[model samples]
Target: MKAFIVYCHPSENSFTRHIRDAFIQGVTDAGHECVISDLYRMDFQADMTEAEYLRDAHYRTTPDVAADVRAEQEKINASDAIVFIYPVFWSEAPAKLVGWFDRVWSYGFAYGDRTMKTLNKGLILCSAGNPIDYLEETGILDSMKKVMLGDRLTGRVKQAEFVVFDSTSRENPLREENWDKNLKAVYEKGKSLFAAK
Candidate 1:
């Protein structure tokens, strides 16, 4: 199966990057083709502008910018699964990643009428300040569920997995080994799900 991996982390040596890399490697080792969109590395713009919307509405898709948007949309359209790997800043996604959602997942591209209904899967791999239970108590996970699975992915993605790291560690918890464990768990789950009926 084809998996589109969207990673949003600024530092090259960040713990977030380490987790993302581990997930990518695991998915690749599982014999799946991976399309990676590294948001920070790409210098994506998080803010949405009315001007860009107008241009898109007019189909004034320039060769460079237009194709870039189309390229990401096409990848989403073709993928069987999507993996979102990023650090949870203030209990939400990084700014540029949010911008990615605003720009890349445009109307008639990421979603539309009943004409385009395809069941796919989405996996959210994120790191936060606390454990899943704590986050749930604070209603963080629910908000993300609505935003990630509800607003953005919608009916296009049926199955959704949330892999969260309890990062209240005194030091960096996203060490290579720890990140590998998380990725391995997610990868195994994916394999099992894929193998099922």
Candidate 2:
């Protein structure tokens, strides 16, 4: 299987980057192909232009999709699965990633008269500053899942999963304690992503 990873992180000096690397290594080790879009490195334009907003809002199917969005759509079509790696901010994915969905999931592509492929899997691996229990207790985790899996990824993939590596705040002592364990889990997830299918 080929996995297209959409990695969104502002800096390389972060745990999210390490998680991304480990996941890729496991994927390659498992004899699967992996393609990556390092959004920050690529300086991808996430904000939608007025024309793009108009096109989507008006439900126009014309080939007016921007080059960048078209390129992202092409990547999805060319892959067997899609993976997203990022850090959760304010109980949500970073603004950049949110904007990515806004533009890339165009009306004629991800919805309406769709041209996008329904992939085998869609996986979201995000890091959070709070503990899992806290996130769960506050219903933040469920909300995140609902948005990512229940909404954005709905009907777009055969199966989808939302996994968060929590208690990752720099000030948290558990951050160092769980670092290796978290990476191991993500790596294993990448390795076994396509095992069932």
**Candidate 2 backbone clash number:** 0
lDDT tens digits by residue: candidate 1, 85-168: 888887788888888887776655554422233637888888776667878998988897778877776766788777677653
- How accurate locally, in lDDT, is each candidate? 0.71, 0.94
TM-score of each: 0.80, 0.98
Highest lDDT among the candidates is held by which one? 2
Residue 25, model 1: Cα distance from true site in angstroms: 2.4
Candidates in order: C-alpha RMSD to true structure = 3.7, 0.9
- Candidate 1 off by > 4 Å: 54-65, 113-119, 168-180, 187-193
Q: Which number leads on TM-score? A: 2
> Total clashing residue pairs per candidate?
0, 0
Q: Which ten residues in a row have the lowest lDDT in candidate 1?
A: 110-119
lDDT of 1 at 30: 67
